[model samples]
Target: METNATTNENLNMYEKAENYTKTSLELIKLKTVSATADVLSTLTSRIAVGAVVAFFTLFLNIGLSLWIGKELGEYYYGFFALAVFYLLVAVILHKTQHKLIKTPIGNMIVSSILKESKN
Candidate 1:
């Protein structure tokens, strides 16, 4: 009777351990899913906004070039002027690329991941 009782207790403990392990795995899986979902949603929204902004800028540039051409009385000269302006801007951006782009983007990604972890 004593041996039987001891065996039963051990079996009960084994079952509890197994249950705890399974629960822990499920919790991890849930957190992983939540974090993945958060990142994907953020990316989707950013892409949508970027698309809208790009189109807006393109149309705005076209309008400005047309107006400049009208003022100067030659369409291609206006485009040439705009192109020069863009080249200057591109050069400036290239010079400051790391400071203007990389650090901020890295910070944003880290913040997003940390924020998701908190949730």
Candidate 2:
């Protein structure tokens, strides 16, 4: 009878562990989808803002460069400045992407999963 009880307890524990594993996997799937959506939304917003800014900036830069090039009699220098501006924008955006990846939402997902498992 004692052996039977021990065997039954072990079976129960095994079932619980299996269920937990399945639940954890499902949670991971959901988190993956959620994270993707979040990143997409962030990128979309940034792109929308960048589109508007870029439109105006492009025209303004063109006018300014032409004026500067005419005054200095060196169009290549004006073009170089434009290139540097674009490179700076790219660098800033790359940093922003890194920061976003390390955000609270990402941390919360892992922390919540750990908290759930502890329970």
The lDDT values for all models are 0.89, 0.78
Give the CA lDDT, 0 to 100, for residue 63 in model 2. Answer: 85
Q: What would the per-residue lDDT of candidate 1 be over residues 4-119, giving only the tens digit for each residue?
A: 99999999999999999999999888877877787788889999999999999999999999889889999877788899999999999999989998888778777877776687
Candidate with top lDDT is 1
Cα lDDT of model 2 overall? 0.78
Q: Which 10-residue window in model 2 sums to the lowest lDDT? A: 110-119
Q: What TM-score do all the candidates reach, one by one? A: 0.82, 0.51
lDDT of 2 by residue, 1-119 (tens): 99999999999999999999999999888776666665666668878999999999889999878776777789877777777888998888788975765676577556655554454
Give the residue spans of candidate 2 off by over 4 A. Answer: 65-119
Candidate 1 ranges with C-alpha deviation above 4 Å: none
